[model samples]
Target: MKTFCNQEHQDQAVEAIKSLVAIPSVCNEDANDGTPFGADIQHALEHSLELCKQLGLETYIDPEGYYGYADYGEGEEMVGVIGHVDVVPAGDLRLWNSGPFEPVVKDGKLYGRGSQDDKGPTIAALYALKAVIDSGAVFNRKIRFIFATDEETLWRGMAQYTKKERIPELGFVPDSEFPLVFGEKGLLQLHINGTGSNTLNLSCGDAFNVVPGGAVYEGSRASELKSALDELKFEAKIDGQKVEVSGKSVHASLADQGINAIVRLAMGLLKIGEDHPMLHFLAEAVGLDGYGKNIFNGVLEDDVSGKMTVNAGMLNIDTNSSQLSVDIRIPVKISKDDVVAQITTVAKEYGLTYEEFDYVASSYVSLDAEPSITLLNVYQDLTGDTKNKPITSGGATLARTMPNFVAFGMVFPGESKTEHQANEFMVIKDMAKAMEIYAHAIYRLCCNQK
Candidate 1:
């Protein structure tokens, strides 16, 4: 494939990313605007469809505002390029150097909420398809670009699309890192419900896929809680009855690296004699163990996807009931039913019931698979680096929504990951490079197919 991507395309790609980032497309369930995701996400979807239409592709948005798609070329077999528009909430605005929704460029990196996690790479993939079409490449198969709106939450939007539309024979999601991901761990989001204490009322956390950075507790004993937190050496601040604990935020997939403020708050509360079922569940049953070693009685790990990790994403405690939202990444070899059984047994001990609300089955595409082998050849030919072979990820992507799909490109090796964190950014240079890769990969997969 010729170098159809140029500075013009890169500039356009950056502009597109900024335009979408400017809109805070975090899911707003209370909008009452008839849009399933909210008004902002509706606007983002409209904007994305407009961009695709500008490239002379046929685009369609679900009338109910669930999902959107753009199509180019015409053939029986379709090549799908999947991505999402919605982003995680911007937690602790004080942590950002600039406004989270305000898009800006400094030090050659574009800073914004959705710049790295998905919007940047999504737009990059769009422009890559543009490059191929602009080059007048002959196509052997139709290409479809699927824009999912609810990827960060429960993927309800994608679920609607699949139920109503045709499933592509094969596809790749541009939501993860490069050289390419062939295997992904199973994603399980659970809500543990139990009884709560009348005295201790606490609630915090943003999303299940994000490691909460800060959790606040407001109750009768402020001074005691502060002392307990200090004794535990946790970073926190207390004012009267309100106490806020601080932790580093990262994606839930990398929960081992993040300091969960919710977990910290529970540990501190327990130290100060706060008796609550959820608190004990968080403090004793979970604590800082990402692998659920204490709760499961052993480490749940496999050679295929490393270890099974867990994150206490959200917590709410009141007089009547309590709910703790947990995000778990199960190893590929582990059965979801088996994992759920273990969790159910342990949760009952703490007076809690394990209820899995969302689940994505683990996915593994062999390196020798048709699209996998072809995509790898494209990467090796372009960058000439074979050291980083196909790998597995703890994070779930749209690729796992269907069979014959894998996640490809956007974040490179040795790059700092800022997804689902404050001040999230994507290196402009690296994004432009990803666009070129997408273009060539698409050409080989759809246009230059034998």
Candidate 2:
């Protein structure tokens, strides 16, 4: 191979990333539409298809609308570089430090909804393939790039695709932390419904996978309840003349974002101080000043992926009662048992009924596993990033499925965690580095026959 660290190869990677991120590949693909992930997914897949075609790889868009490839190399053993093109919705556009769709560059970072998540990494992987092929790197194994959609809400895209076809012997999903992930925790989602409640009526947020942004409790006077919450930390807004609370730097689906709105509202209403169950729950889980328990609760430690987070996302209420729900993502060390126990304990004491939700699990990739080692070493050897060590994370990604799959690098070391956060971004430098890592991994797995 004629050394792929050339300017032309790097430019191709950056251009591919820019093109893919421009598509709003949010979960517009409703299953009913048969476009399971919507037009955005289509656009993302099309972009990948173009790349695959340009690279002279044989491709096929499964009848299910997902696109895959059989980049034959005269070998039965296949290697895969898996990634999703779809992204979680660019929530609370105003909360964004930048526009969700309008990609930008500032202080050496590219900003957009899909910048740091799958798109950035997926494009990099594609370019890596291109670089290797262009450099005349010959191998006996088949290398495939799976461009998937519908990963934001459910992994139907990958699930359906994988079921219909045989996957490569080993692969990586460049959609998580770097230095490689060796372990990932299992996830479960629960949907609790109250028989009924009038005064208890409340619901907030958009996607189930994300922490809900905020919720509303309505009796005869939503206006008055809205008024009471006005002075709180959340900025109260009304849609269709209905009251809603919008806060800065928050999201609706991720649990942590919901906590932002919940704690602020609880602070002014409960007067029970920070130790109050509702306040403490939101604060401790979401990593905020949080009901004044920052010291005792260890609120500042959202490591690997940033912070373990929870959001009081949705609520439903009528004249009789209210149904409150939240989204949560904490570290593996944090017990789900404790989560259930805490909510149950608090609800019983506070005279409230609580239910749990599971949209995605808090996931981490093992740093020492075969796949992780291959991924990390490829990155380190190619980028000379020896100082950085393997890491952990809380943000859920496509790896939640595939029992063995781990999150590789879409986001570089020292970059911000922007997967579900506002103004998500990736750096040009980072994308190039990811390409180098991916190319080396593919060569090691498929070419060298690991």
Candidate 3:
């Protein structure tokens, strides 16, 4: 067997990642009037298909508007390389030293939203396939290269896409940890409502999936609250023009970006004791004590993903209704029934109500399986560090939607998470290495071997 490893292959991989990262495909919000989640998903799919065509890989977007894929051959067994182009809204550009979609490369790191999340990895996999095709190797199985747009919200894109397409006999997604992901915890989203304290006129957050960058509340004492909030310079705007408070809205995911006019006017005066029904409700969603951390430490500890994560993503209050929106991610092993029971019980105790309007279960790629082990072997051949085992995470990818899919590396070690945060990026060099691995794995899988 002749092995193909060279510099020309590496350059193509880098260019592929760069092209995909250039698109601002934030998937946080659905298209207006049920236009399919994340308005930009279609654009991303177009870009993906464009690359596929340029690389001479046969491609199609399927009937579902969520995803598309490029193929390499015809065979009984299909190997799908799944990735998502839909990205979380870059929270707080101010936190990011670089533009989210500008695709900045510095000191061996590329920064932007979806760079580390999945786009970068997706592109890397594309180039990996390119390298295999360029290497003059023939395979018996077809390579189905798919990139999804709805992985972050739920696996709907891949789920619906696969409903019409053939499932791959064995494949791995480059959207999660490397060296094999043996187990993945289920993902859950809960919305806690009715905590909007009438006493405080305004409150809001960044998004449903991230920790709120900031929050604010104002009381009937408008003048007093205004003064205090102005002193603190909180985000969001609150105006008292007609004997009442008017709150202006800001992009929820980017709270740290800056304080909006309404929130700035409402914060500072109100304290945590203001009887926030939403605050209490959110705390209880992920098994946190609903009475705030003072009562139960306000944190869920998990061995796999580390700490149970919670983000106070949204807060709304009006004359007729009040609600608080929170984002919580826990280890996948927790039972859905238990989580629902625990949250429902807590809401009852707090005299508040809650509901889970959104959720995505966690996904696991068993390392023991051939799909995982072969991919891991490909990486080990390149780096030789075997300690980094595939681990479960609160973060999810396109793999979660498919039965056999799992996220592999686009990220290595010593890198901070820039997914929902700011200044997200991936190094050209590191991304090249990832493609090299993908090429090896895909080649092995597609070749006339078993």
Candidate 4:
């Protein structure tokens, strides 16, 4: 592991992360042959696979571009390291000190969109495997590094890969924090639809998993809404018959930390008229709290993953119809069906139709389990940080897509989380340390004699 951690490999890992980040592999809704997530995403995947080949690993890309994998060693039982190259869209570029796609290192931190969320960690894991291979370690099982392009959006790439490829017996995803994550809350995306008037046009948010930073509403109550915005101290302007409100954007998983512009605009409109369907929908159904207490009677909490979180991530309204896109992270013990049923009943009461567009079940890997204990021990031994125990997260990672998988770190304890935020970055030194940790974890999990 020390040999693999040489300055040369660390430098290579940093360079790889920068190259991948420069691609701007944001997933697009448009789909075509060999480019299910658009051409740029495909190019990113191909570039990464080519890098794997250059490292002397056997690599394969799915014909339809759903996913790709770089393999090391040869055996029946496989150890999977799942990660994604796709990154969330860079929001509000003006907030960044550097271009989101132009990777740069300043003050010892690499600044870019996917620097911490995944691209940096993915490269770290690759070099870790390279280290293991270069060390000439004996392997009890093959190691496969699975790369998916749709993780930021739908996870359709992983879904397609699992159907056509082999599932690993045990593995971990390097897309979370260092202490290790044992449980992840279930993810549910609900679309609340209804017809509305008063507001002729409205729009906010590009993705259902991001807290909207700004929104525009054109209606009869523009002046009133502007006054409300001023009273609320929200940045806003009134132009003709439209009002535009600006707020801070953060990941939907950490919705509490952000000021949702869509929610604020809806609140302002409610001051004008409570009967407006769109306004009432946002006020009564969505509410201000990230928790879904106002809408579902707050019946969604558990000991493992704590309380559920709801984010009104996307909203749109016109003269004829309105649609509100809501993203929920449900507790592990809560049943998705039960939560959806409660939301349906409440949505109907507001004269809106409830439709769940995407769902991924909660995942829990026992702390006492072999894979869990093994990875935890590795982190504790390497970092000398034993105070932080295995934890649960509201964020979903590729770990939940396969059996016996959990999310291990690239994020260190107490580090500021920049994922899905403007001007995201990863500490260069931390990334190099992650490479060494990942290398040791891989050797222990895949190579050490039983």
The candidate that wins on lDDT is: 1
Local distance difference test values of all predictions, in order: 0.90, 0.61, 0.62, 0.86
Q: lDDT by residue for model 3 over 1-450, one digit each (tens)?
A: 345546776666566667777777766453574446645667777888888899898888755466788888867878888877887776556567878777777898877777777877887777777777887788889888877777666667766776777788777778766665655555556665563344555545555655444444444555555445455543334556212222322222222332233222223333323445544444333222221233234544466544444444566776556765654455655566766676666667767676886776666666677677777777788779688776776554556666766667767755444566556667777777677777788888887475
Supply candidate 3's per-residue lDDT for 175. Answer: 72
lDDT of 2 at 396: 57
Q: What local lDDT does model 3 show for residue 218? A: 41
Summed backbone clashes in each candidate are 0, 46, 31, 1
TM-scores of all predicted structures? 0.98, 0.77, 0.81, 0.95
Give stretches of model 2 more than 4 Å off: 29-32, 66-72, 96-99, 105-108, 195-203, 208-259, 266-309, 318-325, 330-369
Give candidates' CA RMSD values in order: 1.2, 5.2, 5.5, 1.9
Report the lDDT tens digits of candidate 2 across residue range 55-125. Answer: 78888887767655546465877767677778777766666786777777788777887777777777777
Stretches of candidate 3 off by over 4 Å are 1-6, 28-35, 195-203, 216-273, 280-308, 330-332, 448-450
Rate residue 47 of model 1 by lDDT: 95
Cand. 1 TM to true fold: 0.98
Query: Which candidate's TM-score is highest?
Result: 1
Candidate 4 lDDT over residue span 161-269, tens digit each: 9999999999999999979999999999989999866535777787888888888887677888899889878799889888888977777877777788888888887
Report how far off residue 180 is in candidate 3 (Å): 2.4
Check candidate 1 and list the clashing pairs: none
lDDT by residue for model 1 over 80-128, one digit each (tens)? 9888999999988989999989999999999999999799999999999
